[model samples]
Target: MTTDRISRQDARRNAIIQAARACFRDKGLHGTSMADIAREAQLGPGQIYRCFQNKDAIVEAIIKVIISARVEHMLAVNHDLVRKADEFTRSLAGIAAFDSRDDALLLEISAEATRNPRIAQLVVEADLNLFEQGCAMLKARYPHLDTIQVNALSEVMAVLTEGTLLRRHVRPHRPIDAQCLQSNYLAILHTLFPDTQSNNTRKKD
Candidate 1:
């Protein structure tokens, strides 16, 4: 295809994905239809169809966008996490705000995944990909950790992240103290990594 045609296709795909996210957030997966997405995108149903085979394709695209964002954040972390422990811990605690539109959309998709086998598979695959990426980051930063430890740490982080996301839905109005959040994350980091010098000093003082 010509360059202009490719650009138009890309633009349409993005519009469809953005529209799908909003619809899924508002009406959920099963409730949202192609017509709804078309209206949201301000495009005809045929145009949306030209970009994606079905709603599932748009959902998959949305998952990819989420993965890209998360992986980019992971990549931005310093390799020497021990030395940057305070900074890293604070970054983790910053997630406590839980005001992300993407988080809401993911929660909706996760709920739908439990009942839809195809969606469950896609979610599982995306989760595994994220897990592997996280593990790779951990291994690079802490080469002394064995594979089991690295995997366990990655799983713990995943649990913490998902749990925080769940809390966002259950208690959206709850206010979390940033200082307390940082302290709690610091404790978790110290416990998991087991530094005898700096972490212990901070814990004591």
Candidate 2:
């Protein structure tokens, strides 16, 4: 493409991506259409084509935004929680403020991946990185758990975190109460740091 044409094309592609994000936020992946995104982005249908080939291409962009946003969010952590009490409190607050819309879209995309073998592999590879991060966190806290054991625990934490967050949306009134969520997470954390718990108990005595 010519310089002017390429610049215009790049600008249009950005507009469509921005529009797709807003459309997905408002109407979800299944509900939104390419036309709707084009309208929101203020680009013509033809303009959208010069950028993304299809609606799936746009949906894939949305998925990347959802996953990358949170994955990057996690990497921002740099703190010293001197006690399980502090760590548990942080965990509860973190989970409580998580975006339910993003979670729902991610879950839907994950389910969709199952039908498309290619997408399934990509999704699994992406999630495996998150799992590895969780395992690393647990390993730092509880050095005794071997790699295999830490991996198992990390997977449990992943499942539990997602389950409770979903419950927060599905049953608003019965959402994991802050204390209950902390206590439950603490119970698991204690498994990783029995010495911390024991020392705290002794201090109390």
Candidate 3:
């Protein structure tokens, strides 16, 4: 394909993905259809098909985009560890960064993955990618830590993130204090990265 054609196709695919996200947020994955996405995107159904073979393909693309975003966020956090270590701990405590709608979509997709082999494959692959990238970040920040330690720390981080999201969704009424949450998470971070925490304290002093 020509460069112009590829660019147009890419743009078209992005528009469709954005539209599908809106539809999914409003009507959910199973509730939304190709026609609804087309209407939202202001594109024809044929255009949507040309960009994506079906809704599954579109979901895969959306997941890819979310993963890409998360990778970028991880890189940013890694950078903060080097330059603004104290801020990194505070960032961990701030739960507002995660969008509930996005979490819902991920949970919905995960539920679908149980029944759909293709989606299950995508979830497995995306998770592995995230975990590996997370390990790399930890290794970079705490080079003194061995492979096993870094791997364990990465798993802890993943659990903390996903578990926090689940708790917020499942128990929205049971609100936790912001100060208490920050203090507790800071203690966990200090325990996990003692060297960084000491460095952060020294900088503060």
State which candidate has the highest lDDT. Answer: 3
Candidate 2, position 91, lDDT: 44
Query: In candidate 3, what are the lDDT values of residues 76-98, reduced to their tens digit?
Result: 76634332334333344444454
Which ten-residue region of model 2 has the weakest summed lDDT?
77-86
Best-matching candidate per TM-score: 1
lDDT of 2 by residue, 21-136 (tens): 77776786667888898899987898888778887777666666666775665555421223433444444444433466666666666766867665576677667868877677
lDDT ranking from best to worst?
3, 1, 2
* Alpha carbon deviation, residue 169, candidate 2 (Å): 1.9
Ranking by TM-score: 1, 3, 2
lDDT of 1 by residue, 1-205 (tens): 9999999889888988989989998999999999999999999999999888998888999999998887776677543344334443333444432237788788888889998888898899999999999998888767878899999999987886677666655755545576666566667766776654556579899
Clashes of 1: 0
Clash-forming residue pairs, model 2: none
Q: After superposition, how far is residue 66 of candidate 3 from its true place, in Å?
A: 0.8
- Candidates' TM-scores? 0.84, 0.67, 0.83
Q: What local lDDT does model 3 show for residue 166?
A: 68
Q: Is candidate 2 or candidate 3 better by TM-score?
A: 3
